[model samples]
Target: MSRDEIIDITNKFLVEEFEVDTEVVQAEANLKDSLDLDSLDYVDLVVIIESNFGIKLESKDFTDVNTFNDLYDLIGSKLHAIA
Candidate 1:
């Protein structure tokens, strides 16, 4: 999938599943703050990402993900690796 497709899918799921406002789901937004995600939320995030992109992600994969763009980049890299 293209980068745009990844962004679209990520935003759609964030808004739908996590109940995040569409306006707060921008690339520069802080993932934890925007999603109001706690530790347990990280597990949910991992599941959501795998189900959405068909790529396996460990909690460690999110260690560097401070912003939404970081998460997008991580997913992009994983998808590229799988391809």
Candidate 2:
């Protein structure tokens, strides 16, 4: 999928599944701070990524992911690797 599609899907999931405010979910928005996510929320995020993108993510995969853009790039890299 294209980056725009990835952004749309990720944004949709964050808004619907995580109850994140759509207004706060910008590309550069801080993932945890913007979404008010905790450690348990990370677990849910992992499951969401895997189920939605078919990308299995470990905690380490999130170590460098600070912003929604970071997460989007990470997902793109993982998807590229799979392809």
Candidate 2, residues 37-68, lDDT tens digits: the string is 99999999889989999987888999999999
What does candidate 1 score on TM?
A: 0.96
CA lDDT, candidate 2, residue 22: 91
Give the Å shift of residue 40 in candidate 2. 0.3
| Pairs of residues at least 3 apart in sequence or in different chains that clash in candidate 2 | none
Candidate 1 per-residue lDDT, tens place, 58-77, comes to 87888899999999999999
lDDT of each: 0.93, 0.92
- Where does candidate 1 stray beyond 4 Å? none
